[model samples]
Structure formats: structure tokens, C-alpha cells
Target chain A: MIVAEQKPLNEIKTMIADAERVLLVGCGTCVTVCFAGGTKEVDLLATSLRMSTKLDGNGKVVDEFTVQRQCEWEYNEPLKEKLDDYDLVVSLGCGVGVQTLNEQFPQKQFVPGLNTAFMGLPTEQGVWEERCAACGNCILDKTGGICPIARCAKQLLNGPCGGSQNGVCEIESDVPCAWQLIWERANDLGQIDRLMELQPAKDWRTSRDGGPRKIVREDLRLVAHEEE
Target chain B: MTTSTNGYKVGSNLERMIRSGEFVVTGELGPPQGHHAEEIREKAALLKGYVDAVNITDNQTAIVRMSSIAAGAIVVQEGLEPIIQMTCRDRNRLAIQSDLLGAAALGCQNLLCLSGDHQSFGNHPGAKNVHDIDSMQLVQMVKNLRDENIFECGDVIKEGGPRFLVGAAVNPFGDPFEWRPYRLAKKVAAGADFVQTQLIYDIPRFKEFMKRVVDMGLHEKVAILAGVGPLKSVGMAKYMRDKVPGMIVEDRYIDGMTDAITGIEPLPPLTKRRKALKAQLQELGEDDPARAEIEAELAELAPRIKEIQAERNKNWREKGIQMCIEQIQELREVEGVAGVHIMAIEWEAAVKPITEGAGLLPRPNVGSNGSG
Candidate 1:
């Protein structure tokens, strides 16, 4: 689950203030899951902009629409006809959706309405807690289910630091000590011995530290090019 | 020959009844879990004569619920005043304006503007949130309906233009309590006539909040309604304390419940413990200094425990009937408070007893004539 919060209304209004014909686009993907951009949100933002502009005497008009998924080309093609009618596209989707819309409609400018936060889950109703960092690596098998990259203050790969007080992270009151949680889970599984095994340092080649990365599955590649 | 009541011109007969200090019961009916209308109708009938109005919630928290406009129409058909809650979560300006018009045509006279909960909080985790406009903008939209009667579509309605009794929600207990008054002032400036607050638990803190409201001179511009919800059980109380932000559960309320469980009188145990601890500590103070320090610590614990116990007792006693009275009295005493919005959630039936016990008159039987 991608968790995100919408920017303040004044900021969003200012972003598209100059656009006479605005298209409020909501994504039905991660951003939608995070509630930053979705069909309902798109409608709401468009209505608010229209009302605000009318009150300001500019009489700016806004049209609202939501695509099934804004991150993919196939999902964005349907918006082609409507994209030309707008001076600017206010994307209520996530970072991916905003970029996808920008790529698809290069002629029309795209503005983001949501500040994409992190991959998380709804711990309960009306509460979304971040749980993963998408560090391009999976280490849950060794450290238990808790992800230190997201939960730990230091993102420590080793054991808890001196700052882990009473099984809680010192950085924040509600934040649980990730290393402590890992230790407890390991102890519960009768794997306390695993903690003694000093693992070597992690490689950063495949992660963000190594710059942009891509994966090409040879099995799924299409060989036929435009027969030239 | 109808005369003005309480300095308010009785433009409609209903306005006269509202001004007469009637019960003025208002209940919030959450949109159904799905598209079905049977359950919505059933709940609407329960409050038909009992409440002055029933508010239909929009996609609360960005989760898909039954449409507020549709639910509002249902309540109106059931011969009850329907207050439509519109949030800037799922719709932009155009849709919001259109929905407001639809609501007006369906006879929804009350409007509650809100910047809804984020989408991540809803059941559907993969939903987008639209906060293109905030609550202030929505308030302005309501003001437009009352003034120009023009929607975002640039079209003018020929008949039955909306005349909404606009309201907005506030969270006085939310973080940075200092900023709340300013935020509320902004809402008022945006054209809010009434303000409903989040559930209030600490009466003393709420009094302080009322003082701030008075100090700001907001008493004359807008009516304020204190929001209250009964603590059904100990588990519920704990949930509110541990999870819900902006809710402060007084320490005494928790201890009162603990005493009740042991079948011992709370006041006796609390007072006896405190007196005994204090006496032991005083005796120790004359003897060994270190022992006295330990005893002093113990004495401090006793007072804290007693304080918790007292609060618990107060909450237990006042939760059902006494709390309502206190809230009502608090509302009456406050310079700006005009009413109280009781959000009993599933305890809708208990609202009647609580409000009536508080000496509040029931809202006028507007539905008695069979027209909503």
C-alpha cells in the first residue's frame, strides 16, 4: 500500500491558477490506494478549483476524470482526446501516475496534487503506517518480517544500537524498535542463534546508491523489429 | 400575523421552531456499506420524529460508501430534515457543484462542509484521494449557492435554488491546540454559519477552548455545537485513548471503572489509601531520611492512583445521563455555543434519553404535518 497525503489546498490552487482549462486526473493505482489520487478525489479537487476560481473572478473552468491506472501507457491512451482540451493536467495520482501522464501528454503540463509518501498499510481505519522502503532488496528471511530500512531510525543492518530504549525507537514515541522486533521474532521462532551469525556488509550495486537500474527478462523479450 | 422569535426573523415556519430553544436533535447516519437502501431507510425512520435532521456522510475517509446525495434524498422522503455532508475527497469543483444542485432538488437544506479523511484510511487501500479543494472552498461554494445560485457549469437554475444552513467541523483537541481557534476563524470567514467540533471528553479543557472562542469574538458570527459520543465500554474508552488522535480521556474516568469491577466503593478505597500513605510518609520523615524518601514516593503514587480512580468514577456515572447534562450546561454557559451534536454512532437510540435528561426540548415535530 502506498501512503500519501494531499498537499494543502492553497498550494494546489496556486499550482494551476494560470491554467484556464484544467483537467484533474486521478489514478486508480498505488496513489489511489494511498488516497492521494482517485476518482472521488479528482472530482473533489476539480470542484474546489472551479469554485475558488469563480470566486476570484477569473472564471477558470476545470474538468475531472479518473483513469483505471495512470502509470501505464495502455491506461493513459484513453485520455488522449480529453488531454488536448485542457491547458494543464492536475494529477491526483502518485509520483508514477504524474510522470506517466506527463510522458503521455507531452503537450499538456502535469501537476501533482499529492505528495507521494511511502509504501505502507492501513494499521486500522483512517491510519496508514509506512512499512517498506523498496530498497531494491529483500532481507526478511534473515531479520524476520520487520523491515529495518523503514522502521529503524538508523536503518541498521546489524543488531539494535544503544538508542533502542525499552524496546522502542528513541527517535519517536510511537515508532517500535525494529531491531528489537526482529530479535523477538527470531527468539519466538527458536532462531535466537541466528543473531550470533555476523553477516557481512550489504552490497549497494543493485540499490539506489548505484544509480538507476533496470531488469530485462530475456524469456519475455520480443525479437521482431519493424522488418527492415 | 407571525412574529420574530429570539430576534431571528421567522422566514419559514421551521426557523421559528428552531429559534424557540426546541430539542433540536441532529443525528449522523453513515452511508450504507454498499448500494442497498433498505438499511438506510430503516435508520432514517428511527430518527424521523426524534431528530430535527439526519446528516448523510459522503465518502468518509475516501472509502466508497453510499452516495450522500442519494442518502439525503432517502431521509427527506422519510419526512426528516437531511443535512448533506460534502467532502473534497472524491470530487473536483464541477461535480461538487452539480451534486449540491442535485441535493437541493432533492430537498436537502442543511450542508456540512469537510476536508475528508485521507484515502489510505479507507477499506480500499488502492484508492486515490482528491483534495483539490479544502473545507474553506466548500464553504464558499455553499455561500455561492445562497447568493448567486450559479454552479461551476456556468448554468443558472430556474427554480428551487439552494438555501443551505451551512455547517463545518472543527477539532479543538487536535495537535497544536493553539492553531485551532485561527483555523476555525478561517472557516467562519469562509461563510460557515455553524461549527460542529470533534468529540470532546475533558470538560475543563473544553471550557478553556470555549474561552478561546469567546476571546476571539466568534460568538456573534457563528453558532458552535459541541460534539459528544458516549463511551460504551472500557474497551471503547481504551481504544479512544490509545488510538484516536485529538481525544483526551481524563485519568479519573479510567480508575472509576477499575473500582467498580472489584465490587468495592471507589471513594472509600481511594481516600483511605491516600490518608494511610500520607500518615506513613509523615512518620518516616521524622525517622530515617532515606526511608522517608521512599515513603514520600509511595505517598505520591497513592494520590495519583486516587486521582485516576476519581476520574473513572466520574466518567462511569456521567457517561449515559450525567455527561449529557454537563455537556448541555457547558454549552449553555459558553458565550458562543448554540447547540450540541450527539454522535452516538451505533447508540442512536440512547441519544433521546440523554438529551431529554439534559433538559433539552425535542425538536419541533415538523414531520407531524407529513411533509418534510
Candidate 2:
């Protein structure tokens, strides 16, 4: 899941300081599960902005709206009519949602209220750790399901980079070395021979190095038959 | 010294020394953080007759410095062979190949391919690193360029290509101890000609690593240069022992360094004397005859303090060099050990004494015969 956190209140205030009517739009998808930009968070932020702005003697009307999924076009249909009522729309969604809303309503000005952190699932009750880099191509099968691209500090393919000790990374004792986990997993699966084989230089053209990525599934697209 | 017997690749002085079964000593020279060619020359001069080839580190510890190839060129000018260190952190394959051609064109014959320290550890932590290829792939790429005359993309060089005495690094003390020897084997398979290890402090573990290498017959495939460095001080030993990962600094050296300055205080005695004189003057009468004796003692404090501080530093440094010499001597007796790579970081002058103390001085004059 895409993980993110709400921006600090003061920074958000400065972003919409010039506006009179502010709409705090929340996404009910990834941000909702993560407790950041959900309906409850948006309500809290609206109340804080109302009270804080009133305290500063420059009180502006603040409102709240929640979208089922901010990333999808149709899920944001309820926002089209209401967006015109506000001078600035604050998106309590991931970066994609902010861009999506802007693209959907070209005349509207939207600003992000949360910082999109990474694609990860919560490892514990309140803590989350990144699990994937979305490096276009995946090599997890060979590494015993461990993603070195996301976890290793150096992103080393043939690593544990002379800095891993006692299964911990040199960067810190809190972060377990990815390669150590790979080694142990490989050992458990009796696939040590696979790791013994040298992994060649990675082809990064599939990654962000190839520029912003796009995918088109021909099978999923509907088209008219020109000949008919 | 025996000339290159036959088919010595690159034939660098360090390579030839290894091929001829002579225990070679290679020293490290970190380039200055600025454009100071004289710093390279000065460090090169200290390592000139002491080591076969000095490694010019590339942005060592991730702090930007003069380019290793540029520094290597300067070292070559100072009458010493240079092993140019290259890291994958800052360059893609294109830059790596371009720099390899540039380095080879500039009289650098030895190349130590490394996955550099992470940029987060350096001054530019905000910088984005380009680990386009790992060090293993780099080794294979350089090998293909040298032997097959092809680039990493499989294009024909069609002209002069970099002919490097390829090198890599291993950390025998790194975690998953069972996999360390296998990592060396992988480097050897990837076409590394010589391998230098991370600093060795725990000799028994290193012996275990070497036994595995010798058992697998890997000792015959590549020259294994054990990394050794002078301790410098008790603080450095403690830092490496407690902080630096993948490093194993035995407590014996820490205890030994502590013993070196057992009785001497690190602080100069003037501070001590100031306190003593203040108390003595406060306690004594102005007319007392014994006050003259205390004044005479204060007068002698200046030179005595200097002597004591100098003695403390000398003792610590002497112990550091002595310990390094002892490591070298013991490493030479190991079954599969080839030579020692002394990394006297920022202490270039210590390289001479460490090498000399280890009986590795008067480095063999291989002359220009076997140089590729």
C-alpha cells in the first residue's frame, strides 16, 4: 500500500493562506488505512484550521469532503460541483490523488496536504516499513522473496557490502540487513546454489531511469472496429 | 627478482610480484578533498620504495575528493605505480567504462573495483547514488574489456582498451561467516586477479577464512592481499571495535594501546600545574621561605610538560606501528596469504615505518621489463 503522512499544520496553513474558502478533501483508500488523510483526519484538520485561523483573526471558511478513492476518476465525481465553491482545494491524499484531481478538474487549484512516503504495508500496529521500490523489473524469486532494491541501503545485488554484521546493517542496528535475510531464506529453502551464481549488472531501463513509467494493457482497452 | 615468467596479465609491478610468488605490499593513499596534486605526490613519495603499488582511493568514505584516476596519474609521475580504486556508487556502466579508458590511458595499470561506502555515510547525504552495477558485475565487465576487447554492452573496442590488473575486496569478518569464502570465489570467478580484504584484527577468524579458501583451491586463482592498518590510538581501536560494522578489532590491541599510555595523562601538565600553584600559593604565607621552593617547581613545569606529552604520543604511535608489524609478520605465515595492503589512513608516514618494521622495505625493483 502507498504510505504517507499528513504535512505539518503550519506548512499547510501557509499553502492556503491566501484563500478564503478552503476544502480539505480526503482519500478513503491507502491514506485511510494508514490513518493519514482519512475522513477522521480531515475532520480534525478542518477543526484545527478553523480554530487556529480564527485565533489569528483571519478566519476563513473551511470545509471537508471525503472521496471513496481519490486516485480513480469516477470516484471523485462528487467533488466536481463542490470544487467550484472553494478558492483552494487541499488534498489529503497521496501524490497521485493530487495530480489526478488536478487533471480531472483543470480549472481547479489543488495542493497536497500529505507527503507520500513509500509503497509499504504496516509491519506492526503503528509502524510501517518499505517493502518494494517498484523498480519495474522484479528479481525477488532469486533472492528468496527479499527485495534488496528497496531494503539494502546501497541496493547491492551481490551484497551484504562488507558492512553487515550479525544480520544487521551497518547503517543502524534497527534495520536488519536485507542480504542477511536473503541468505537465511535461501539457506532454508535449500537454494543456496542459486545465490552462488553471479547476478549480472541490472538493466535499469525498466526503472525510473527510463523516465516516468507507463503501462497499457491492450486487452483491457475497448476500441471501435473501423472496418465494420 | 625473477622477470615475468610467461603470460602475466597486465604485468603491473604488484601483479608481477604476486605472479612470481613474492609477497607484495600495497599501500593506500587517499586523495585530498580538494584539487591538491601535491598532496598526492607527497603521499606517493612516502609509499614509493615501500610498497609495490599504492591504491588511490576514489571518494573514500563517500566524501568527494580529487578523482582517483587524476590522483593515480600524479602518483605515476612521482615514480610510483598506482592502483586506481573505482566505486559503483557514483557512476553507471557508461561512466565506469569511460573512466576505465581514461584511467588506463593515464598510466594506471591496477584497478580495485569496489561497491563504495553508501553516500549517506558521506558529506553529501542528500545526493542520489547511481549503483547501476555492483562491484561483481564491474569485475566481470573490466575482465571482458581487458581479455575480449569488448565493452560491457558487447560492442567491439576496435582500439586500445583498458588492460587492468583487476582487483576486488573481501571482508572475512563480515556476517554469515560461512558465505565469506564463497564471496571471494565469486569474485575470482568474475575475473578478479587479486583480492584485498577488509582490515584483519581477529587472526583466528582470518585463518579460518584462509583455510576455506585453500581447501577450495581458490588461493591459486587470485592473489589475496590481507588488509592491515595501524591502530593510531586507543580511541580509534575502541571506535572500530564498538562502531564500525563488518570490522573485528580484537580487545587485545585495545588493551595493548591502553597499556602504551598507562601512566601518562593526555592533558599537558600546565593545567595541572596551574591548579597546583593556585592551591600552593593560597596555602603558603607571602614571607615563607618554602614558597621559593614551590616557585622553582613551577618554573620547571614548562619543559617537563612538553617532555611528558611528547612521550605519551610517541609511546602510542610506537605501539600502533609495532602492532601493525606483528600482524604483517603473522599474516605472512598464514597458508594462503599472498601479501599485505597497509591502509595507514591519513598517516602516510606510518606506512614507511610499518612496512620497514615488517621487513617489507627495499621493495623489489621489477624494472620495466614485465609491465604490460
Candidate 3:
């Protein structure tokens, strides 16, 4: 799941500083799971914005709403009508959600309320850590499921760097060395043979560096939306 | 051994010592985070006659500091060999290559290629990490530039390239302890002329790592320096044990200091007070009238305990240096161990005495051999 964090109250306030009427939209999917831009968060942000704007005598009217998933067109169709009632729309969603909303409602001004962090899960309550780089190509099978692309500081395909100390990364003690985790898991599975194989230079063309990527599933796509 | 290597000026004694099969002694200088050339010159001078070469650290621990190249040049002025440490932390390949050339032009012959400590570890936690390439590739690239006269992108160098006796670091106690040796092997294969490992207080683990290196014939390919440094104090020991990544400060070593200071027969006063407070809290069940008083006393006891430990640690400087000397002696017995890299961070004054006590004085004169 994509994890995001709400921007600082002051920063968010500045984004909507000149707006007299605003619609705050939250994503119920990834943002909700991480407690960033969920329905609850949207209400909280709306209440705070109202109080802060009132305190500043900004004369702003803030309205709040949440969609099932802001990244999907159908989930956001309901907001098309509500967006026209506000001078601006503040979206509390991951990067994908916010971008998708902007693309769908091109005429409506959308200010992001949350900073999309990364694609990861909550390791524990209130703590979400990045675990995947969405590199398009995955090597989890060879690495005992630990993604070096996301975990290792340098994302070296081979193994741990010299900075790894006592199962911890030299970067910080709180984080585990990704290669250490991979080696231990691989060792336990008796898969040292696979682990020993030096991963060749990755073709980064498959990653975001290659450019904007899109998925086309002929089998799943609706015939009406097929390319001309 | 008493000549130039790979067609470049030695400009340093450390490279000659490594080539001559003499156990090389090296130390690191964390260039002060300021612009005072005297500060660096003073630190370099302290290490001049004691160590074969001194490494000038590059923004170590990610804190901003004077450039290692600048400091290395200062060390050169002070008549000491400098190993300018370069990291892939803040620079892209272009910037990295440019700095390498600049350092070598300044007469720093030895270069320690490292994928520097992450920026989050330093003052600028929010800074972007520009590790355009890992240390392995950096080592390979430096080797290619020096040996093949080509850049990583295969551009031929019109001017002569750097002739660095490439160095890299290893962590014997890094995760999955077993892979530590293999990682060192990869470093050697990648063209590291020498390797200085992370500080090793766990003698058994270091011995195991060295044995593995010998078994793999890695020792013949590169000189392996076991990292060792002073603990300074019991608090420093505890900090390394608790905080430093990949550091292995043995329990026995910590216990040795504690036992030496005060016999283990009696519980520490703080521990006793803490236990007593816990007992009182449990009895009071959060509703007792005396709970507030106990809490207040508990807070007071903590600082008193710290004061006691600090007092004991006041005499730990000698103990720390003695332990370092002992570790060096122990390395002499370990096969495939070339020497030690003393990292006396901010404790530069101790190097002159520590090296003298370890019988490493009269530092080998490799400087002349590398000077063309």
C-alpha cells in the first residue's frame, strides 16, 4: 500500500491561503490505512482549517468529503459535482491519488494536503516504512523476499555494504541492514546457492527512470476504452 | 617496494609500507567542522611520526566539515602522508571523479573509497543521498580510471589519471556475520588494495573473519587491517555497544571495566534504588499516598548513578589506550592481519602515546618511495 503523511498545518494553510471556499477530499484507501488522508483525517483537517481560518479572519468556508479510492476514476466521479461548489479542492491522498484527481478535474485547482511518502505498510501501529521501490522488476525471490531496492541505502544488487554493523545499517541503529536480513533468511532456507549468484547490472529502463509507465491488460480492459 | 606504483607518485609512506609486506599502521582524522587549517595541521602532526599514514575523513557521520582533500593537502604541508577518504554520499559520479582528480593532484596517494555514512546520521538529516554508485562500483571505477585510463562511461582520459592505492572499509561484525567475509572478498575482487574493517572489540568474531579471509586466499590479494580504537570511557563503551552499527564491544570488556571500577559483588546504588522504587510502586498500586514521593526520589537516583559512573570513567583514558595496545598485540598473532586502523575520534592527543606504547614508533618512511 502507498503510505503518505499530512503536511504541516501551517504549510497546508498557506496552500489554501487565498481561497474563500474550499473542498477537502480524502482517500479512503492507502491514505486511510496509514492514517494520513482518511475520512477521519479529512474531518479533523476541515475542523482545524475552519478554526485556523476563522482565527485569522480569512472568511473561508471549508467543506469535507472522502471517496473510496481517489486513484480510481469511478471512486472520484462523485466528487466532480462537489468540486464545482468550492473555489479550490485540497486532496489528502497519495501522489497517485492526488495526480489522478488533478487529471480528472483539470479545470479545478487541487492542492495536496498530504505528502506521498512511499509504497510500504505499517510495520506496527502508527509506523509505516517503505518496503518497495516499484522498480517494475522484482528480485524478491532471489533475495529471500527483502527488497534491497527499498531497504538498502544504496540499493546495491549484490549484498551488504561495509557500513553494515551488527545487523544494523550504518545509517541508523533503529533500521536493520537489508542485506543482513536477506542473508539470514536465505541461510535459514538453505538457499545460499541462489544468494551467491551475483545479480547482474539491472536494466533500470524498467524503473521510473525509464519514464512514465502504464499497464495495459487486454484481457481485463473494457472493449469500449480500447485504443483506436 | 621502494618505488612508484602503477605509474603514479607515491607521495605517501602508507602505500610503501603495505607493499613492503610490513604491517601497516594507519589512523583517521575527522577534519574539524570548521575552517581552521591549524586545527587539522595540529591533528595531522600528532599522527606524523606515529602512523605510516593518516586518513582525512570526508564529512564523517554525515556532519558537515572541511573537505578531506583540503585537509589532506594540509597534512601534506605538515609533512605527513594523507589518505583522503571519499564517500559516495553527497556526490554524483561526475563530482566524485572530479574530487578524486583534485585530491590526487594535491598529492594524496591513498584513497579510501566508501559509500559514506548516510546523511540521516548527520546534522542534515533531510539532505538527499546522492549515492550515484555503490562503493564496489566506485572502487572498480577508480581502478579502471587509474589502470585503464577510462571513465566509468568509457571516456578516455586525455591527462594522466589518479594513481591511488585504492582502499575500502569492511565490517567483520556486519549482519549475517557469515557474509561479512564474503563481502570482504568482493571488495578485494573489486580491486581494493587494502581494507580497514569496522572497529572490532569482539576478538573471537574478528579471528573468525580473518580465518575465513585466509581460507579464501583473500589475504594474498589485499592487506586487511583490523579496526581497533580506544573506548575512552565506560559510557563510550556502552554507547558503542548500544548505538554504533556493526560495532561489537564485548560484554566481557564492558564488564571488565565495571568490575575493575567496583567489584560485581554488590548491586549498583541506582539499580538498588530502581528495584526498591518498583517494589514500592507495585505495593502502592498507583493509588498510594507515598507514590508521588517515590517517583520524585527515583528521578533523583538516576542522575546520582550517572555521576558515579562518570567519576569512574574519569580514569578510563589510560584503560582505553591500554586496551587498544593489547588489541594491537593480539592482532600480531592473528594470521592474515596486516595491521590496525586507529580511529581516535576527537582523541588525537592519545595517538602519539598509544602508538609509542604499542612499539609502532619510528614510522616506516614510505613517503620517499612514493614521491616519484
DockQ list for all candidates: 0.02, 0.70, 0.34
In model 2, residue pairs whose N, Cα or C atoms come closer than 3 Å (at least 3 residues apart or on different chains), thus clashing, are none
Error of 1 at A135 (Å): 27
For this target, which candidate reaches the highest lDDT against the unseen true structure? 2
RMSD of each: 24.4, 4.6, 7.5
User: Residue B13 in candidate 2 has what lDDT?
Assistant: 85
Candidate 1 Cα deviation (angstroms), residue B126: 1.9
Provide the TM-score for each candidate, comma-separated: 0.52, 0.93, 0.81
TM-score of 1: 0.52
Task: Give chain B TM-scores in order.
Answer: 0.75, 0.89, 0.85
lDDT of 2 by residue, A28-141 (tens): 999999999999999999999999999999998999999999999999999999988999999999999999999999998999999999999999999999999999999999
lDDT per residue for candidate 1 within A79-100, as digits (tens), equals 9998879888888888888898
**Candidate 3: where are CA atoms >4 Å away?**
A6-20, A32-61, A64-78, A103-107, A122-128, A136-142, A162-174, A188-228, B1-12, B255-314, B370-372
Runs of candidate 1 exceeding 4 Å displacement: A1-228, B1-23, B152-160, B256-322, B364-372
Task: Give model 1's clash tally.
Answer: 36
TM-score for candidate 2, please give it. 0.93
Error of 3 at B244 (Å): 1.4
TM-score of chain B of 2: 0.89
